[model samples]
Target chain A: NAGVTQTPKFRILKIGQSMTLQCAQDMNHNYMYWYRQDPGMGLKLIYYSVGAGITDKGEVPNGYNVSRSTTEDFPLRLELAAPSQTSVYFCASSLLVLPDSTEQFFGPGTRLTVL
Target chain B: TQLLEQSPQFLSIQEGENLTVYCNSSSVFSSLQWYRQEPGEGPVLLVTVVTGGEVKKLKRLTFQFGDARKDSSLHITAAQPGDTGLYLCAGKDTNAGKSTFGDGTTLTVKP
Candidate 1:
């Protein structure tokens, strides 16, 4: 399986601009998540979906939106980008949340710079 | 909100030496995971400890979860240059369906 894959390895956006970060998983995972990693800040969850048509806000959901229309795809949208949004974004998926099956498969990550 | 704090935010050591890094939190978790990340890449899972006081070892690395389920530690024996990376610990909140990540410990092993 290709596991989880994210598009646009690198991107630069002007202030107030918008873009969609695409993610897909071939594992048919029911849980997909979007996280951003800032220098020395680790990974912060932006949004997540339990399944298609369902999404929830995470710790840092501001300026971001997500849609999980299929089991394989979970895309993150950044509207009116700001310099604060500059960070590396990662997409991950897991088959289940049980103790033994919660291992998350993560994508290579997309580096975003907002000016 | 549950927060995880990692110690020795940055460590530089010579190859063949041993080192340990810690991840502590005040809140309990259902399970905890360890991951290693290289520059420009996402983290890859190293191991997950569910039961408290559980110990799992991978090659030269050993991972242990605290008996109270509030902390964990990673110990590397005879570290190598390949072991240099960002080590992160994440506490899983199954009920919330999310894992809280630690700031991560950056390790640099010199040959």
Candidate 2:
């Protein structure tokens, strides 16, 4: 299983520009999440999906959107990008929620730079 | 909001030395996890502790969850250059239905 994979390993966007970070997992996980990591900062969740057609806002969801149309794909959209959005983005998937299972498989991550 | 704080934000030590990194929070969690990340890469899960006072070991590394379920510790014995990376702790709050992450501890092992 390719586990989780993210597209555009690196990207640079101008202010006000928009882009989509694509993520896919072959593990058939029901839970997928998008997180951004800043230097010295662990990670801040942007959005997550319990399943296809169901999404929720996480800790830091501003300037970002997500869609989980299939169990395999969960994409993050950044609209009107700002310099504050510059960070490394990661995609992760887990079979179940906490108290039962907390093991999350993560993607390599996409490095984004907004100027 | 639940928050996790990691101590010794950065650590540089010689090979063969031992070290411990801590993650503390006032909020209790249903489960806690530890992950290690390398430059330009995403974090990889090291272990998860679900019970209070739980202890898990992975090779030269040991993970312990606080008896109150509010803190954790990661101890590495005889560290090697391969162990150099960023260590992160995440707590899962069942009530909040979300995970809180600590700032992370950066460790460098010199040979």
Candidate 3:
């Protein structure tokens, strides 16, 4: 199984440009999440969906938007790219977030650099 | 906001040595997870401890959750070069229905 997969392993963007980071998971997970990791830091929650059509903002959701149109895909959109958005973005999915299911599987991550 | 703090931000040792990394939070958690991340790849789940004082072992790695459920520890026995990477600890807050992550502990095991 591909588990979780992300497109455009790496990309370079200019200030004010917009783009979307694609994320898909084949594990049939009920919960999907988007996170960003800055250098020398841990992953910060960007947005997440409990199920298709049910999305919510996470710890750091500003300047970013997400849509979960299907159970297997969750895409993050950056309306106006900024230098602060430069980081490695990761997509993860878990069976569920109940007390018994907490382990998350993550994708390789997309590296974005705003110049 | 729930925050996780990891100690010994960096560590370097020769193979066969042992090391321990710590993650602490003032706020209680319903469950906590540990992950290891290699150079250009994503983080992989190592273990998860829920109950207070819970202990789980994976190969040569030992994980422990504090009795208060507000802290955790990861100890590697006879570490190998392959164990070199960033170790992160994340906690789930049932109240918020979300998880928070620590900055991470970077370990380098030399051959």
Candidate 4:
């Protein structure tokens, strides 16, 4: 089964442009997250949703927006992209949390470059 | 700030060598996960340690969680070129439903 999938594998945008990174999961996981990884750096959380219609800010939420309106989709939006926003973006999904929650499953990633 | 910090940002070694990477933090974690990532692909889960002082082995790889629940380590025995990749550690976020990832450790194994 396709666990997690991300769209627009690669994109180039001029400054001030807007775009959305699409993410979908087929596992019906309740938790979804968006993260960005810079070259040689660890993944930084951008935004997350615990379930449908529930979104929250994360460590690095600036210049990004997210919506979780369904159990299978969590999309991140970049409005007015900046050079600093150029990075590889990833989406992840996890099953409902308990003391024994499983590890997150990740998407291949979307590479975005802003000029 | 990242909840976890990984050490030895980069490592290079010859085949058949042994190596260890560390992930440390001041906050207590309910669970810590290790992931290995290749170029152009997402990180894949290697193992997850939940109990303090617990050690888990997967083939030639060994993972241990610190007694205090604030640190963890990944040790590779008889490393091969196939083990070269970016290694990351993520800790479950106690304040939320998500987990925080540490800056990854890049490993290069030469044959």
Candidate 5:
């Protein structure tokens, strides 16, 4: 099913630059999430969507925005990049929020570095 | 936000030894998941324990959820080089639609 896929495996951005990280899932999951992993730290959620038109902020949503216009695509936007925004980003999808449905499939990851 | 803490932040062991990684939290969860991540790669789900005191096995790996659903542990038997990676635990709160993650346990199994 190709599960979940993310674009731009590696990227470097200058301070104040902007870009969008793309994520897609063919699994037709109802839930999609964006998370960032700083070096030597646990992952922190940036944003998430429960459905195609429903989006919400997560643990760490600063410097980031998201849009879920379709069931398969959830994109994260960086308005003005900062060194603090440098981290590995992951996209994941799941069927629902039920305990049995908590198994999330993750994309390879997108590594971003801001200078 | 709920927090999860993992123990033995780093470990280096011989290929044939056994190891256990722990995830603990002060809050209860509906379910807990274990994942393995290799360098430059996102985590892959290894197992998910939903019920309190539930136990599951995969190959040489055994996963156990705490009776109160506030903790979990992953044990690997006769570890191998292929087992070297960062192991992570995530706790899910269905009602909140959010999953909190532990920092992770980095394991190095030398051949």
Candidate 6:
């Protein structure tokens, strides 16, 4: 099913440059998320969507934005990229949280290096 | 926000040895999931425990959920080099699609 797929597996951005990280899932999951992982740190949530028209902020949502135009896609937008934003980003999809889904399917991850 | 903490942040073991990784938290949960990730790749689900005090076995690996659903453990009966990877535990939170993930345990198995 190709599960979840992310675009631009790697990217290098300059100070103040902006870009969008693309994430899509073919499993028709109702929940999708964006997370970032720094060296020696656990993955922190940046943004998430419950459906095509509903979205919410997560633990670390600063310097980033997200849009859920369709149930199959959730893209993260980085505005005025900073060195602090340089980290490995992952996209994940799950059926639903709470009483339904406990397992999450993750994407290949996008490695970003701000120079 | 709820938080999950993992112990033995790093472990190095020889082949055929036994090893255990722990995930703990103070907040009660309905379910817990374990995932393993290799370098340059995303995490893959290993197992999920829903009912409290539930125990599940997969090949040489065993997973247990705490009776209170506040903790979980993964035990490897016979470690192999293929088991070398980062292990993470996550719990479903009340915040809809959000979840709390523990700091992963990185294991290195020497064969």
Candidate 4 Cα errors over 4 Å, as ranges: none
Candidate 6 lDDT over residue span A28-75, tens digit each: 999899999987667899998889988899999999999998999999
| TM-score (all chains, Cα) for each model | 0.98, 0.97, 0.97, 0.98, 0.97, 0.96
lDDT of 3 by residue, A1-115 (tens): 9889999899999999999999999989988999999998999999998899999999999999999999999999999999999999999998874685878899999999999
Stretches off by above 4 angstroms in model 6 are: A97-100
TM-score of chain A of each: 0.97, 0.96, 0.97, 0.97, 0.97, 0.96
Pairs that collide in candidate 1 are none
Judge the docking of candidate 4 as incorrect, acceptable, medium or high: high
Better of 5 and 6 by lDDT: 5
TM-score of chain A of 4: 0.97
Model 2: what TM-score?
0.97
3 or 6, greater by lDDT: 3
Residue range B16-37, candidate 3, lDDT tens digits: 9999999999999999999999
**Candidate 5 Cα misplacement greater than 4 A, ranges:** none
Off by over 4 Å in 3: none
The models' CA-based lDDT, in order, is 0.94, 0.93, 0.94, 0.93, 0.93, 0.91
Q: Order the candidate numbers by DockQ, best to worst.
A: 4, 1, 3, 5, 2, 6
Model 3: what TM-score? Answer: 0.97
Model 5 lDDT tens row, A3-112 = 89999999999999999999999998999999999987778999999999999999999999999999999999999999999999999999974567778899999999
DockQ of each: 0.81, 0.74, 0.79, 0.83, 0.79, 0.70
Write out the backbone clash pairs for model 6. Answer: none
Backbone clash numbers for all candidates listed: 0, 0, 0, 0, 0, 0
**Count: clashes, candidate 1:** 0
RMSD of each: 0.9, 1.2, 1.1, 1.0, 1.0, 1.3
- By TM-score, the better pick of 1 and 6 is 1
In order, the interface RMSDs are: 1.0, 1.3, 1.0, 1.0, 0.9, 1.4
